[model samples]
Target: MTYPVDLIIVGGGPAGIEAALAASHKGFRFILVEAGEIGASIRRWGHVRMFSPWEHNTSPLGRKTLAVHGHPVPDLAAVPTGAEYLEHYLHPIAQSPELAPSIRTGTRVIAVGRAGIGKSDLIGDPRRADHPFQVTLARAGSSDPVSVVEAPILIDASGVYDQPSPFTEVAVAQECEASVDHYIPDVASQRGRYAGKHTVIVGGGFSAATALRDLLPIAAEVAGTRISWILRNADRKPLTAVRDDVLPERARLVEEINRIATSADVPGLTILRGTRIRSLVQLPIEGGSTDGSGFELSLAGDHAGTLTADHVLALTGYRPDTALLAECQVHLCYASDGLMKLSAALLGAMGDDSAADCMAVPAAGIETLRSPEPNLFVIGNKSYGRFSHYLLRSGIEQVETVFDALPAPVRTAK
Candidate 1:
């Protein structure tokens, strides 16, 4: 099946929802394709709370959209968990009558390219600009055909949650796969699985800190349980205590993690800094049997030692999934931070500690959002690529900029 539309928006998360709303307001018809439920990525990290409060997280436009549906405004200062952000704001905006019809959940976009032209032909084809985009879609789980949609514009808002950066890019022993948890589970609910187990948590970001802090209490309660925290940066310090932060919860979390790291007095907790995993080998379980039961890691760097664990939680980071956009021949930075044109801006912003925050990096404007492929742009977290600074507020601002910069609509003859 094929449907012609004015714009095709990929992803159904916060950015995609904002794009759909912007398109609707601009009088352009669009369809949003999502591989899973709306806010699926956030749902994965629902147990984690956001550092920014509701006011900073939501946009004026989103509020208006929700208001149209008779939804009441939430407390501006309340910082919501991932679940609350989805339920109280995003879900309602997505379900609003104006945006609901355009949303297609559980539909994954397989590929995107120019209609009637291949990637090789896009360079010299004079008709390429006039040609519509061919977007291939398939059912979430099934291989069966769903439909091919054609549109003049394509917005790639797909974020990075689907792609997890491996602990080591090198090939892993097949046996090590079974002991890893890519996504953090609700530790409280899954305490039994972790009780009395030796676990290693990798990475040094907020996620890593959260995992360590959450596990501290469990370690105290469960006998024989041990925790290993590994970080690549030897110079990295504990989370800063943000006493005057607008969001007190985030401030509290930061202080808690800071205390744990600075004191180094937590029982059953060990910190390994400036370490890298050289190799992972399965450990023998019991009498004459190796069923990939446990594992040991050969390490390098400052620690320069091996560690054994019953379970490994790698909270490293994520990167954008650009496989779907390959067919469209969109230009991405060699560093994979964002569009090639954005290198200077992103780099410049990074040099300034305060500006490193994606929200602090001034709105790149809709012009900055464009890729080599005309009318195709990437927004939201996906736009940041490997850069971890992107904020929800920045994504919302990008949506407004895109709408503001949209060209005037063409009228059809009667």
Candidate 2:
């Protein structure tokens, strides 16, 4: 049976763009759909520098494609901020003549399923591969008048950055929900909001560290600028400093953030270890009220009490948006929400002390990229799901593996 397209690639990030490149090289009929402009998510956090340098972040296929189009490559050894990555690599690849016409920006994938079948229709049935995938698409942020496209295969590279985990395991208060900032804020650009104000930052990942790092200078320069860091771990050391780390930037970050937590030297800075925010509410700022314009947070765990802050930064990590593939037969890990097999492989890698360095984790085998739903694969950070250890390099490798496993296109577009 002839399908309208050989594959449907969801997302326009690095992984998605790589998949599109691979498909183009293989002469497959494909379309890459993105909810926003290509690299929209990266553009959102464009200010933050990535730990991995350009050499490790880009794929060989992407590099070749760009070189063929006469695009100048970036210095492979230099660490680039998110903006640099987008400006030098992702944007050029997406705009390359090879991929430009095949991409559809401002389009969001609503759902995916096997054509003419429900989620339960095929159970471990090899014949399931015979049916093309039915993909529902709508304009981003709209639900009216959806359109359907069919493909023999589907690749979901939609990442997790947009779905940030809540500050607390439990449901957050309405006030907290309305007030907190989930993404890393550009402290340099938003100095007016943070200067001389008490800001509370939560989470223990690189994002949290990045926020603290950016805010420390602000705290030192602005009098009355109070900053409180909340960590659920009693260890106080929120970041792990990989011994003799290869990435100099990552090593420096771990050392600096850990030093702040351990020494408590920065004035107006407070680190509350083993503490959790039980509830948060915005305090009314009335004229003459010295209580300040901010939030009152009830705490629990090691530091159980109440704290006040003028701004709250919920730097908690993100989880994959799994709802888009609700109709597909995909098994996700109970813990990471990643593909079951890949999650298990990653979890197994964690047992080794070397795995402490994300670069040390073994590349997941191609089989782990497979799902019960044939011809459907989730690649990139989305494949890692809630797992925080994903590197751009891993996503690049995933694209290679998925394409390697696919058979040659039944018919190439003329």
Candidate 3:
């Protein structure tokens, strides 16, 4: 099934929604695809609220939607809870006439090949099975033949949080001791791919904290599987403080882990605090170095001394999934922070309008969002990777830019 819309949006998060509205006002037809339910993070992390408020989430177009519908404006600076952001804000914005019809939820996009049809002026990597521009979706109701959406304009609003590969993969190889392997093995095999293993996790951010809080119980239930919580910092602790924002959910997570930690009784469940991983040592054997099929790690400590383990879980952090960009052949200027900057500098580059700051990426690595191909552009969190507030502001910048690119309808003198 091939349906060509004016534009095809690959993500339905804050960027996707806002971009749709901007496209609509510009009078270009578009379709939006979301792999999970809309606002996946908000739904998955429903227990917590956003650090920024509702006003920040609302777009110029979004604000107009509220006004036309007779809805009162929300506090601009109030960061909404995850649930509130979804129910009150995201849902509302997505339902605007600007969206809805073209929004295909539960549609997960696999690959975005470089477009040949429109011959995009934007600069970036070339897509694999090139087309004018195509978006392939994995959805239940999709016809037997499957659906292939072709658009002149494609926006890669897909964010990074979704691609949590595996803590093991993210681990710095040198940090592993002679016997250590994998930073977090469980996340690598769990569910989609990373699951069912003695996974080690190390990080001080919200992602690490959430994974630990939720995955402990599941690990305990399984007979031999285990979880080793290790962190490198002053004093033995759970890396960062359990986020107080999630209050009840955070407490529940801690409570469940406590019970499991006490009952698992298996010495296998160890929490190495105040120590850092030294390196991963592969024991040499006739076939290959085999300490454990999936276990091995050596660690060093500031005051706690050094140790060894089967696998290490280093939730140090994540950069954007820039690997996918390689496939698309997108030209990326590396930011000190790893965010990709667009190529074309904005028409209105800067001003006191605060929002205009995102107009052009002033960062070193980030130059412009221009893809290697013409007419191809990226949006959402990806657009604001390093320089600007990676939140929603950069998304707005993308929305307006793409909308402006499309040909506008000429006025008729009555």
Candidate 2, residues 325-408: lDDT per residue as tens digits?
A: 888889999888999999989878775463277788778888899989888899999999998889899998898888888888
**TM of each candidate vs. truth:** 0.91, 0.95, 0.60
Candidate 2 Cα errors over 4 Å, as ranges: 173-175, 285-293, 352-355, 412-414
Residue 326 alpha-carbon offset, candidate 3, angstroms:
4.7
Arrange candidates, best TM-score first.
Answer: 2, 1, 3
**Candidate 1 to native Cα RMSD, angstroms:** 2.8
Count of clashing residue pairs in every prediction:
0, 0, 71
**Among all candidates shown, the one with the greatest TM-score:** 2
lDDT of each: 0.81, 0.88, 0.57
- Could you give candidate 3's per-residue lDDT for residues 251-290 as a string of tens digits? 4544555454345364446666666655444434467645
Point out the worst 10-residue segment of candidate 1 by lDDT.
Answer: 351-360
Error of 3 at 167 (Å): 3.1
